[model samples]
Target chain A: MSITVQGRQAATTAAPAPPGGRSRGPARVRWAAVAFVAPAWLYVAGFYLYPLASSIRMGFQDYTVSSFYTGVAPYVGWDNYSKVLHDGHFGETVLNTVLFTAGSLAFQFAIGLALAVFFSRRFPLGGPLRSLLLVPWLLPLVVSGTAWRWILDTDSGVLNHVLLNVHLIAHPVPWLASTHDSLTAVTLVNIWVGIPFNMVILYGGLQSIPGELYEAASLDGAGGWQRFRHITLPLLRPVTAVVLTLGLIYTVKVFDVIMILTQGGPAGSSQTLTTFAYNLSFQQLEFGRGAAVGNLLIGVAVVFAVVYLRATREQRQAGR
Target chain B: MSRLLRTSRLFRPAARPGALAALAAAGALTLAACGTGSGSGGSGGAPDTLTEIDYYDAAPQNTQLPQILDECGVRNGVKIKHQQVPRAQFMPKLLQQASARSLPDLALIDNPDLQQVAATGGLVSLSKAGLSTEGLYPSIAQAGQYQGQTYGIAPGVNGLALYYNTDFFTRAGLEPPTTWAELAADAKKLTQGPRYGVAFSAVGTEEGTFQFEPFFWTARGNLKELDSPQAVKALTLWKDLVGSGSASKSVVTWTQADVNDQFMAGNAAMMVNGPWQLPTLNADKKLHFGVVPIPVPSPDAKPVTPLGGEVWTVGHSKPAREAKAVAVVKCLLSQDESAKWSKDAGYIPSNQRAAAQLASADPQLAAFVQEVGTAKARTTELGTAYPKVSQALADAIQAVLAGGTSPGSALSQAQSAAKN
Candidate 1:
């Protein structure tokens, strides 16, 4: 945003002071701007726009393996969408995707906020401790996911071992091997992976609020909870909104973590829309239906963003 | 309209509607040009170096296969650039390359996937390239065919066998079991603290189905009749194994490699795996293992297993490059090389005579060699539809083993699922 302002200032200052400064100056500056932005524009067009357009177009065609080579895909209109929507596993998959995303976000945010509030107080080793919290975020998802897989293994896992020794349960839980627990197991891992991001963002938000508000509130007989309620929560709303919005987007399309841990398995109990789309496209070789599922996922993300934006807007208006 | 007029007047003084139309046409042409077409390379003239790709990213084969490719490249008078991708990513990578019309000059595709890749019309017919499947196992030869034309040919092949820890069997006063009843009884007896009696893959992938096929086929389960009684019985065997505490519940999550790791670590007394694990198992000098054909329902019943191997296919490219690729394939499939590859890579030779020689020379591989005689190709019955059916079957196994679904009902669901 600042770069754009700087660029505009430079362009204006240079526009009228050149040799052919009156008529051709603005056009030349505009052409120069276009030249500067061409690489980025071409990159967006080639990578993002082209693939998104292809995926959407593919959803309306009977694309298949042969279609890739022959470049011949007959139009099928709504057939792919209808077929995916009517699949026997579709309802279960949607439910799983919802539960996985909601469970991950709620816990991640709550725990992250608590930790951020705790870390707001200065103490010895606080800097190092806060930096250490970023380890999960720093590691590649695949590497951490694989490590989690071992830690969650049923009979041999350290988790079950510790749980058994602590007498938490009578039997070792089949974390990845049972259909009943696989979804919860994957969600727990995702929450663990996401908490670091939530914490770092919310922590930054917590730091930006003025200490004077808390000091004044305390001076006026406002207790800890009262001060936090009146000052902290209201002040952190915008940052909270950004954190949750990005969190929702990231969690909705999480593919690698679940893939590495479960592959949506133990009889598809953990299968989500992202993995389902992938399975349809690559595993089953039904590219059209896969693209349709992919489009539906995009619809889901868009719906979430719109509803969230509207709710936050209403909240801001009400705040005034 | 005003914005457009201002922009055009600022940019060009002589702009007109015709000129705008011409510019739009030029832009559309440029966009269309960006769309996929024949990919770069292998153009202008056929190069002397041919490209080859495979998923042999494991030890022994990973290191050994490149040497073989170099030898074949020398024999064919062309330099071969061999590339290997991980097993899971191999098919997706190949499909992507195919769509871009930039398939490698040669590809060693898994046997079951050959039909799917060939169906894309991205592979050169081996017959047209002057290659023959003569002397290869009939099942292997059939595996390479798509629409009655041979698109690939295998130098060597493999099939599942029961690898047992000899130390466990000896300590327990047990003999190698040849029938399902004895196998189950022995597995129960072998189960002890911190150890499973048996381990096999039941993961949600083709490897899971590949590991399950011996029991499935030995029970006379047909791929087209997935809900038949035979299929239910096969699934029930696996469920009973886990339920009886002879197999771990974790079998549903294990790949063949994981199962092998369990068996090598003494956590599993026996494993259902292929000959490709021999090198790794042998590397552990303390592990004393013996191989046998997967058990049958009765002593008289024959054990039928799926043939597992990779087949070399010449990819569609310039005529000269394809001819050179085919020559390399032919060299790789010659009788001497076939026997050598079978020995070095822990596979059974696809050629009957070469296999017979290998079996006698290496008594340890006799079980796999013998199984290959009766082994069937996964794609022979369903062709390109096999992968879908295989996935359905894998899901049924996981359902029965992990989801607690009855075998009959799970297979029934799988059958209906595969139909679409």
Candidate 2:
């Protein structure tokens, strides 16, 4: 399967030998390849790597609002990290971050995978219907979050209105107002924002898996559930890895949606690490602490990425 | 996946190791660029044009500032380019500009934050640039002075006042409250069915803290001693209102704008808000509202509201450009112009003479003018330390109002946060 071939390409011992006839042009082609990727590399170095290094450097310094102008921040070594770790809100924020990530990822993936499988079934206007599902993904998060805020407003929100009308509860739910429910409300909104992304990615992965494999499974007298369990799940592993890894990265760093909704508030109940870092840097004017939190967020992303790659590598070895 | 990848590819592809490296590099460069390239700078010359920036990104002021600035620009013989950023982004953007050594020759900063920015040694003291703070309200003048140096000067100033629904009050047959006991009793009596008797932001932001300042200071509470008995009394009044179901529990999350919305919708009988919301309130013709100074802890206690307005100051520049920038600022704040802006923009004038002339003529701003006379500069006592304390106070407000924490404990906790 090309999926396995694509997966195995990473584990190759050395660069694949050029076709025998191409030897005369290898040097020119090599230079041309370098030329093709050079702009991307330059863009990368100029934009991303430099600022990241600066942030990492700033993480060790006592950066502040004054530092923004003076360009001087005394090196504080691990002081910022230690201060952040010992912060009163740190434990709750970290626990909230974990809960937010896990809740958002689980639902986003499940709903996305389900929709991907559902849409993979041929139907009238299937293409248009699938395209239509991308609206939530297209709307700016600020716009969506604002709209949701109105809908979830405890006093006049339409969500509470509908629920009350239907006798769902005796009183309105304080979606953004109550600290107890604020995290759940934020997570739900995040999940809604993420499902479209998951659906689209998993749907593409479903498409890449050839139909003949399913047909072969059917010929072996496998039932619908049996075929899906045996063939679809196994073959879609590469795509699942792609969806999950990307989802983990995105979910762990969700900020704007939360910021627009709660601002890590009602006494910092809904704060995630991203908002905490932002609050420290921008709101508190403590850039060093913000940078430390930001570095820790990157550490989280790295751990997830490593796990994803390790699983991919194991699958590749199994294929071999 | 192809559909998603196709769109993702258009913007950013999924970050593999190489892509992650590229992503970081791209992000770093774009972020760095925000602080690089002297976005606005004045070199050593009699420049024909001077860049100016402010946070007047809302109506009346946003539309009014440019015309006023241009008139000043014309008088000073320099074309002024004004940039209005979102109010929230104003400080961060200014700091970025300052860091890049590209601060505009002319800038308008919120009065309370001027001290913090001035302390950075980025602002050119206006006194050094031939601008006078004379004829300004004492408290308003205090906002522009950091230590002994005057770094900013306002054309106009504003303060919080009570905006009560006339219809609601008339129906309840109650006069506007002048003391804390009356306020609490009237608030409880007026609150009925769907309407909250009073609304004020206790949101976890500067706006919340700004709204709380009137009550806090009126009770003779100081930011440095937030855990004092007087401060606790001030917070308890708000807690009682919410606890008695006289105000919405959601006030902890409401901005002044939100509070105004509630008042306009008849959901709130009264609100503590600034004159900046006056234009919007005036737009709703059916909303019969009356303005009064915020009620004090007692009839004899003085009401001390926080000063609200942006002060125009010159950024770091060579003498030639600084002279021109200062000239423009002067023209913007001249006696006639200050009065004109105060009238046109519905803000209280900083020029006390202009303010007095208007106070008798424009009854709508009379209460605010009275309040601005004694309005305290939030940073006057705490100086640059005010923002931190303001932040802590705002959080304490949230804890007390929303989290149901006791006022005493919350204030003490916030007081410690401020010290740290």
Candidate 3:
């Protein structure tokens, strides 16, 4: 509380002071502000920034399993990157990552939005049902992935058993084992795992939309769809932007799901960039190439971050 | 417009403190979750105490190993602080510690991974440490060697063999097959509605490759050439079983544990597994399983399975600490101690002389012990390159069984991939 008061007082006091003396006013206030942010700054720098920088630097070096112990990896500029780019699996992996991210986001968002709107029309047990929906998001991804793996088993899984008993299909589908089906299977599992996150965020957004706007729109002769189109969506634009931007960042790094489900197997049909990087580093001990793939992944996340920052800035300015 | 902008819900400085507090709470939670494990009590140049680590998280190894370690610790005149990590995290943890130069005084490493760890030059050669492996199986001893220097040794070892449901064989009026052809015919004849005739791991892991190697090596497939006709023959056998529905398509996902589960659940009449499953199988009072050498291509073709087990290794430490660790290893590998460990852990003693006596006393382990004489060290030919090749072979098995690819082409592709 005092920090804010100090900041405001310094800003006011600095304005009237001479140029040379003005720095003294804000400098004292700045130190107080920095004190408030120090812990968070240290957290981000240690966990995120340091690891990212090391990964990028390692990508240019000839790192291997032995390098970890010896700490003697030599730099051979661009060699790791070239190897990753020219690799035959790289193109297909990129396509898989794109399809996985796009498909998961589209379904997760659409289904989540629909559910959010439905729940907005409060009914019996509404609050309980909303809380129940968050169970998926609360569980560890490893536990969820293992449960889904059992459910999607080819021969004895409950899914195939039910489908076959109901005569939904003549033959059982190999959900996890087949190359053609694994991508779809993992994506479906990821969608299930991701839906609760979307629903909760969207539900919060829905609740914050004032009820009077709908009432006012209805009085203006705006029907259900018309009111939704004019009032609800426009008001929800900021929330939607926040949701989709965060969703893109999270989905692009989806590793644990695909890993536990298939380990990106069956001739690497379901391999994504994240699992590919893991395989290169852990399985094959080609740490440099793994870091290169990891850097490429960071590039993807950075692109989304830049676009989000720009769009949100524009949204803020346009609101004026 | 400016008043609206100033009062807009978007610029809710009122919410900023709450968000930051929540973030701080989250950061605290994450930090707590990722907190480093308490530093192990024994450290650098310590004479009176030493540290030992291994992945023995399951019974009876979990129970049995600690007892033996305690005894050895007492005999070695030092207090041993033992730690157990989960199996999957064992190698990654060891590597991290190696990088930090903070490895335990002694580590129990999987035999196939021995070469990879040894190659990092962070292990003290047993010979240099004045440790002798005089009575151990040559292959078992050889598994712990890299570039002709012994770095580790095991008290007991394991290998894969065919474990059949004896009741199923008696009911079907048949004998356990000695050759691949009879094995297939018996498997088909025994298969009933909703029950697979056989189960094995083809689960895209080292275990899957471990199970595959009996046939692979019997047909003369070497680690160097994955695309050889012998390798394809081995893969084709797996394909034929799954394609014929004698083995479930789920074999592509089943680990050895899962295969044992299927056999115990009556979903399968036979499984290819190791001595490690004996205790679990015996725990089910109704289940009766028998062991045999894994069937080869023909009656006379020798079944060459891969040697399996963890070897006790001395990590680089001060001379006194390493000497203490070596004494503990020696105590663990003594003839009497090895025999007791083999009995309790369901493993065959690595000392061949001790194993022979144990085999006569316990017929359940005879087949695996016999195979030990012929079982190939997975790291022998390719050393550290073996893991990449094994991974390729595992993927090839998955492709042929689950992806419907032909064995010939799948193995060739694996060969190409591994070569690159």
Best by DockQ: 1
Local accuracy of candidate 3 as per-residue lDDT tens digits, A57-173: 999999866776787899999999999998767998999999999999999998998889988997999989988998989999999899999899887789999999999978889
Model 2, residue A142: displacement in angstroms? 1.9
lDDT (tens digit, per residue) of candidate 2 on B134-195: 87888878889987889999989999999999999998899999998988898998988888
Q: Give the 10-residue window scoring lowest on summed lDDT in candidate 2 chain A.
A: A24-33
Give me the candidate number with maximum TM-score: 1
Candidate 2 residue-wise lDDT at B404: 79
Give per-model TM-scores.
0.91, 0.88, 0.90
**1 or 3, which is superior by DockQ?**
1
Candidate 1 off by > 4 Å = A1-22, A306-320, B1-46
Candidate 2, residues A83-129, lDDT tens digits: the string is 99988789999999999999999999999999999999999999999
Worst 10 residues of 3 chain A by lDDT: A30-39
Instruction: Return the TM-score for chain B, candidate 1.
Output: 0.91
Candidate 3 has which clashing residue pairs, if any? none
Off by over 4 Å in 3: A1-40, A208-231, B1-46
Note the chain A TM-score of all models in turn. Answer: 0.88, 0.83, 0.86
TM-score of chain B of each: 0.91, 0.90, 0.89
lDDT of 1 by residue, B108-214 (tens): 99999999999999999998777888888999999999988999999899999999999999999999889888889999999998899999999999999998999
Model 3: docking quality category: acceptable
lDDT of each: 0.87, 0.85, 0.85
RMSD of each: 4.6, 7.2, 6.9
